[model samples]
Target: MRALTPALAVFALAAVASCSGAPDEDIPRRICGTKISPEITRPLIGRTGAFNEYSRLDNKSAQTAPCDLLLDEKPVMSFRFAWSSDQVDPMKYADAESTDSVSNLIEPRRTRDRYKSVVGDDGAMATVACEKAGESHFTLTMKLPDATKPDTQLRGDIEKFMTAYMNATVKEFGCRSR
Candidate 1:
């Protein structure tokens, strides 16, 4: 038994190391018809389980579009894009809908002047001016139903992820607001 101890230890260490590495295979490179960076989205979606994406964006000119990310068949994140005739306050919207599990919405200081955005532990929201399709602005709201990260770290990641997602969605849907 003593002779096999070292071999067992090595096996255990290898297994742990492999498990701790990045979960590239589990995360999708694209979501909701938009290509995404796995590194930017991993913290929100986690590193395990089967992943799937469902999107309701058939109408490019539609006022609202929704997408969902699932882990092991359970919803992990949800995204909604809405075009409104008037500007919507992201902070107020997030605050009214926030639950006990989520932190208060905070405006990101680094956000560009073109966008109004808020970040929280469980979600993020951003709105950009848009004139196309008769919409005054485009709003993107993301909800992380299964997020487990701390407030500070999660908010940072949410900002980055939300920015990328919102930009990509606008371009892909040809709603650049010319």
Candidate 2:
């Protein structure tokens, strides 16, 4: 039965490998037609699920745009971009809205002077002065309704991802302060 033992071992290994849940390769590299680095997005997307993006971004003249990332047909993350007549502080907005899920809202230290942003355990928000856009200020927000990371790490990742997303959207939409 020595030969049979080797064959069974091989079959067992194959079964285990197939069962191991690896990250989904089909996760989108872009959201709302704005390209983003996959490295920054993968952590929040989780491993092993079909991903779908639902977006309604009016790049031409809309004052507001919204996007959602769904995993296995369930909403996992939501993003919104809106134009405002005045600068919006993310912390104050969170407070006014009484968002209980958004704890630990801290402004990121690396952002430029014109950009005001805050990252929390479950979300991130930012506003930038953009005189050339439809409004005087552009606001971007990301909400993780179903995040699964530790608070500190999730906040850091959310900050990084939000920064990248905000930059990409601003450039794509041709938002200019000048």
Every model's Cα RMSD, please?
A: 4.3, 4.8
lDDT of each: 0.74, 0.72
Each candidate structure's TM-score, on Cα atoms with residue i matched to residue i, is: 0.77, 0.75
| Count of clashes in candidate 2 | 0
Cand. 2 Cα-lDDT = 0.72
Q: What is the lDDT of candidate 1?
A: 0.74
Model 1: which residue pairs collide?
A: none
Q: Per-residue CA lDDT of candidate 2, range 1-178, in tens?
A: 9989989999999888566434335557887778887777876765547778788878877468788888788777788877888777666665424554232333323334346877767777788888644478887878887876677767777878888888898898887774
- Give per-residue lDDT, candidate 2, residue 85: 85
* lDDT (C-alpha) at residue 63 in model 2: 67
- Residue pairs whose backbone atoms clash in candidate 2: none
Candidate 2 lands at a TM-score of 0.75
Q: Which regions of candidate 1 are displaced past 4 Å?
A: 1-22, 97-114
Q: Which ten residues in a row have the lowest lDDT in candidate 2?
A: 101-110
Q: Write the per-residue lDDT of candidate 1 for residues 1-178, one digit (tens) a residue.
A: 9999999999999998676535766678888778888888877765677778788866457568788887788788888878888888776677744453222444323355357977767788888877667777888778887767677767777878988888787787776564
Model 2 stretches astray by more than 4 angstroms: 1-24, 96-114
lDDT of 2 at 164: 87
